[model samples]
Target chain A: MTVERSAPPTISEVAAEAGVGRATAARTLGGYGYVSPELRSRVLAAAERLGYRANALARSMSTGVSHTLGVIVADIGNPFFAGVVRGISDASRARGFDTIVLSTHESLDEEIAAMHVLIDKQVDGIVVASAALGPKTSAHIAEAWSRGIPVVLVDRAVPGLELDAVVIDNREAAREAVTALIAAGHRRVGFVWGPPIAGRPDRRRDLVDAAARNLWTDGERLRGYLDALDDAGLPFDADLVMVGEKTEERAIAEVERMLGLDDRVTALFCTETDAVTGALRAIRATGFRVPADVSLIGFDDSSWAAVMEPPLTMIEQPMLALGTRAAEVLLALIDGAPRSQPDGAFRHTLDTRLVERSSVAPPSA
Target chain B: MTVERSAPPTISEVAAEAGVGRATAARTLGGYGYVSPELRSRVLAAAERLGYRANALARSMSTGVSHTLGVIVADIGNPFFAGVVRGISDASRARGFDTIVLSTHESLDEEIAAMHVLIDKQVDGIVVASAALGPKTSAHIAEAWSRGIPVVLVDRAVPGLELDAVVIDNREAAREAVTALIAAGHRRVGFVWGPPIAGRPDRRRDLVDAAARNLWTDGERLRGYLDALDDAGLPFDADLVMVGEKTEERAIAEVERMLGLDDRVTALFCTETDAVTGALRAIRATGFRVPADVSLIGFDDSSWAAVMEPPLTMIEQPMLALGTRAAEVLLALIDGAPRSQPDGAFRHTLDTRLVERSSVAPPSA
Candidate 1:
């Protein structure tokens, strides 16, 4: 250590200066459990005198629980994830837990590495919006479970992993959103979404299974759209379903492709916030009006969506509830609750609401 | 611990199964140092057969370096902060480091607690967008330095603590922004911002010193605004400065208060993204047009600012650069680089530029 940098005053120094037992001094300074005001003040005064301060890391090593939760999200730049993180933080703090948040940026490899980092940090439990890691590539997650650390899934659940998950009913709500647009007399509607990973052919030709192999969320949303088309007695125009990368620029490109189709989409159903924003920019750039030129319904309501020229109609996922519930389940598991059968993981699916704003109207005849 | 849940097969089991020395098995399995392909594959196959996996915690205990960086920000919901975090994560990953990001939500206690949590986690270094902790309450920070962990400040520097900081020339940027509006012939302008703290007695006759105690970032911005007024020979009207909590609702309320001023301000200057958004909503709600009715300029350019009916002309902070630079500096310090003199800390001031779009005009003259 450098000579100019003297040692930081320790808990022992404060304890000795306050003339109290180490445990009492700790209770006074750590802000955990209980300590008498008189003792607290004495310890605080001594800490002030000797320059002793609270050291949470030291306490964690002794207590075995770091009082911190690790949260791994798909992306932090996305406002939807931001809302969920805020919800998690709000609930976590209320329950005396701090959160260590990491963004995977939608990479399975990054997600696995992040989980390892979180485990090293010794977070009590983890809540992740995973990258849909396949069973063959999921050793890190299984490792977490094997070590007795709880894990909760948010937004999307992996098919092979038996884990607690909190999610909104993506399929049903997506179908409802599309149905509403169909009811508004749109025969040609385009669905813009990210194609989940490929290579695993659905052995079971079931719609649910087909969707599950892709992103659990995207699959459900797609299934709902497909089911809505069937209910409306509309043909499943594969050309109208734009399955490509899930990025703002990619969404715009898909939209442009849909516009150039022989049966140009009269209505667009966007499945993410970035897609919606990008679609809006594309529509404006093409010299088209919102409802007047292209009716639209988007996913995940935002403050900006509300303030847009014509407020957007969106399927509002209960974002905060998803995060809070995930944390709740993970905490329960961490607090010694027995894990149910691997086939019977605790899964909570919240409902989403269609917020009807001015962005959608009857399609042109 | 349960009868049905057997203990995870340990490293020893894998080593024995692999028919290799413990150290060789460890190297092969841990992805550290060097191991031949044949040995690595053998060890991996044996570990797979035994359902054995590496534990990062065990590794961290031995190495004493978590290979993770802790970043504590004031607020994660703020887009400006979110951009900074994304930059930090990008830079961290590029250098084979992972970040454990924590949000203090502007609470000093939370920041301090977060610091302890990170320290306990054994992170290599820390980068903090500190809450500008008061001198009397900042021993926790000093303690970290005493323990030989480096901390780098972003956006604001603590006056009492000598630490490396990455910042923009907030005062100059503010003055230039305000000067632009002033030069546009707007004599009466509303300055909307969040008050530093609720109970701070700003009884000091000097405005420069008054703002410093609240937050370094806010104080510098405030000082710049005052300097602009002083330079332009305009009177400093305290009533024109709306100081309240920094939230959308509070901003709306403050804007309403400004509109109700005896000499209602002609134009508005917002100091944050939420404030800018709220001000826009308020203006729209009041049936006022941008530049035509109330010329406006906002701090922290945003995506929504571009999509607005009249694109906003505002100051753009190099948010990503701020995070990247701070992390880079801290990483340098962590690499055993000699510490510079405490009084001459490594200070980086990135430039802020005015992005002029269509939001500003000659005050309707």
Candidate 2:
């Protein structure tokens, strides 16, 4: 090999400087097979002195451990995902690992591509807030697992996948939020966001069927909304629930149509940040007042929520905790920890807190 | 070598199945040395049939190109950086490249460690919003460049480093914002969030000296503030400037202190998101009204700013463009494009839009 002092020092140069065999130096620096303590120290010291850094790819190929975690989220620009990524990065860094984050823009095809990339890179583990919902859609994830790279799901869970998951009790959280609206004497409550249904639901069964075919979180939250209506002995009004693609523009149009109905929605339950913002904009455009003409409750509290006209009452998800727990679980699996439950999965259901400010009140006459 | 049917296919297995030599298979699959079109197609077809995937680590070692990029930012949780990352990720994905993101929390040591990790990963290039300042603090970046991995900076630039940088003209942005406040007939304008300095400054020279030792954006913005004051022939009042750690609590406390000063500040210019939030909270807590009691102008517009009681006027940064331009420059470099400028560096200065809302009004006597 050519000895070029200007380029980064090679392993052979490090070995020569350490007065050890190249094989020993490779084993010590690559963190694979055994090397005597003395020889390891000598090689490490020589590496530091020569500014020699081991290539992670070569090391990963030999040891099957990249000391890196891969995270795939829907969109990193969204505040919720941003917080979750921060938690995962902080937790992973503290545990002596690096993280690679990829955003799929909620596309299944992109998610598949990202999964393939992660597997090719040989990450030690993965934490995913998956866009895939069922077994067929999640074949890429299963392929990664079969290759021995464990994956931990966060924010959402997939059916028929026996893997550790960190998520909030979406059903219970939605139930509690809707129950509060009912307790405030609201007979007509609107659900502003739900699963990506193909058409508007004209009956309760339509929602139930759509939920079954979509994401686990969406299905659970829809059930929670239905539960609250049942608890109040109120009939589920299909017109009061917004369906189809959950976009801000669609949310505003749907909310406007609902408000203009012969029987108006007395209050609204929004399950996401964009939904809340869209709802507020619609309310303002329709010349309605909050907690007076229409009471509102939203999910995912932010700094702006606290500074709104009357402030906002929100259900705050444990976003950071979800991310931290996912990383921790993935790291444990990477260390060869056995699954604790009989189903061979670790289900960590975190709690969400209701922050009551001034936005919720009795429905106006 | 022994082969197992249950395991992922190996290169050797692909070579045997394709009726080619091992070296030919390696060259074809690893995307390195040239192979005849006939043999290359045969190897690729065989690999596809056997579900053989190329390991990025092994391929990178052979070809010196991972087709991946590394990004280092202050915090992924922050809205500004979140938008920037989204742009970078989207742009990189369009070019068929994967990105690895890391957050430094504005810590120099963490930035250094992140740089080292990226180098070891053998990424084709890096895009960074650096936490390092002068040559002493920026040695790690230079080292990476010298080793053939190009780095493109975004958001902030470092002095004495000849490298491509994507940034807004921060000095001009701040100057225009401050000039707007002055045009509103406000002479005593408070400048919130400056460089992190020790002890309170009693003279303009103190701030000038501190700027030289801190971040490039901070220094430029500070210079712009000074420029606006000079244009109005207003004597620089050190008492109106808030320095040191730019935390939310400090911003609130300093604004409160400024309002209570013998020569009260008639308007406030906040240079960051947190500063604006803190200033608003302080104004509310002090029983002062925005615009009527004190006019405000802030940097970095967000959705919350538009939804405020009286919509805020802000300097809207090209956050996404910054990331996109940085990625484009880095990609060009990775593709061996020559620098356009004679100085051997690409300096992309994007413009900022000044969105005038209802936040500014004539200050009350």
Candidate 3:
């Protein structure tokens, strides 16, 4: 049999061939309303004969709803963010929402720009896991809100703005992790912190017996650490505390330096995944074994943590709950419910738990 | 000095204190609309006195465009998809779009549901990296198109559907990799393929034989492999050909079984990243060094491929370009431009190149 040789016809050509207006042809061929059955049949026949396909772009513009959801994340490479995004997708699909994802690369400007583009496209709702939330960003969101849009904040919280937010109890989780380490016969431990924000000031002070700088999550987590230490009757040592950036390389380097100092830390208390991964890698590279050469406790129970050589001991954040709760709250607000019930701030904080893994152990002599 | 202990003020309380209508006070304090100077000052004063924080959810429903983009991917854990997402985010942010991400988990039902929910929310456009596309899915997309929504397909393509799509030359890349093995003086070569799909009948034939199948990508790549064998004057061995699912463990097991057969293959061609990683691990586990015992070639030059103990020789796809092009095309189409010039099927194919690493070498006798 000879192969069929003919180009597919265009929508405009089909419209012209059928002697109908472009709009009529678009409506008829696209299977929409307001077209006479006779004219619609003619348009359909012409389209079939000419092999015309309707343009998706034009159709989307007229509909107003693109059947797409915009997801803004700090980074896709981070396994934690990846898991949360996965959870969001699963939940959204269950609710009939197609997703469009954008990564901010931890830039405030990029995050702001993404917001504008998604808004211009008129996305149904926005779910943001932002790294930095400045005053301008908050104002931009406020503008969208005034226009009757729905937004949910995931992972991180904006200080002043009141939006539907999903987050784990960072302070309580950190305190419990440190408390566990102390219970396991460890007194001296090092802490790693996140960005300095006004919402968490005590965490910074709890790092060392120093003045409290304006920091939120980090400070609260640090306070939990201190509370645990005080409860255990252990004196917090300034020399054992090191506060700076959070990453594997930086944490590893800091740990190495501290280990080489006159008074070395007996156990490690890492507040982030990066810090924990770095500490483990550093310990391995130095030919030291976990819980044998040094005991360790970490935050954020990521997937890789469990699969690591000596499975990590960490605080497990309720990731799926965070996404589901955020979606539910945002949907509720979209349905026009009062922000509060004449009681208190409409804030919900999910609890976190400590998971004992192979990484943590009794203090090494 | 006594620390101040008082409850925060409510929105209605602020409205009463400001002596303005509740709606006007809510609008002003919530930053939803334009307010008179005198009224704005009064509302601000009242809010400050009441310590009122505007609710994000309430504000969003009042706004039309939520300043969000919806992103859908198959699996976020897959580093390849993760990288593409990062590129989309980077480009989107540069253009000012906030992203909302969802994962379909390779389910068609989830894909359809996601589309519906996003539509209900009124998203501007959608970018989808679909798991698999069938006629029903295409029809659903056609419905969305009729409504004037823009969609950009990434990594995957649907036949007989007119939409903007971004894809790398998978077949050519696979063929080139196989050809390289032949050039390095390997006669007996084994093959590892991904899961077979029924919708792609031609692809199945290409996997079996080129003359009968004629799939654009798989056929071309299979032809490339046969071309190398033909040029080398090596007889095609049917027993050496093997097809298996795409997974590290499965690929490794298949390769091991193939190796156990009498007079087994001397070189291998892996068409997917998982298969390649599995083959590498199996080779290492078997105590056979790459290019020393049995030569190998991999498709898709992922980060881990380069960082592995012995760098992998593989095909490098233009991943970022694929996403950017898809976005640009969808945006153009949304702007009322024809899908293609001359009103016919528009197809664009990108070139793939082989990066020579240490993974390939002549077979050892």
Per-model TM-score, in order, reads 0.82, 0.86, 0.61
lDDT of 1 by residue, A1-365 (tens): 11123655666567788888876775566555577889889889988877664454544444557778999998887878888898888888899999999999888889988887877676889999987745666677776764446888888877667777787778899899999989989988888764633332333234345445556787778888888988999987666665555678877877887777777888889998777877776776777778987899999887777777777898888888888888888888889887545784557888889999988888765
Sorted into a CAPRI-style docking class, model 3 comes out as: incorrect
DockQ agreement of candidate 2 with the native complex: 0.29
For all candidates in order, the CA lDDT equals 0.77, 0.84, 0.64
**RMSD (Å) per prediction:** 9.3, 7.9, 10.3
Model 2 per-residue lDDT tens digits across residues B178-217: 9999999999999888767757777787786686566788
Clashes of each: 0, 0, 63
- lDDT-better candidate, 1 vs 2: 2
Residue B125 lDDT, candidate 1, scale 0-100: 89
How is the predicted docking of candidate 1 categorized under the CAPRI scheme? acceptable
Worst 10-residue lDDT window for candidate 3 chain A reads A207-216
Clashing pairs in 2: none
> Tens digit of lDDT per residue, candidate 1, span B114-186?
8877776768888888886555667767656645567888888776666777888888998998898899888
lDDT by residue for model 2 (A1-365), tens: 22446657766778898999987876676565788999999999998888885675666665556788999998888889989988898899989998888888888888888887787777889999987777768878777775667888899887667778899988999999999999999999999886677677777877877875766777888899999999889999888888878888888998898899999998999998889988888887898889898999999998778767778899998889888999998889888897446574558989899999988889887
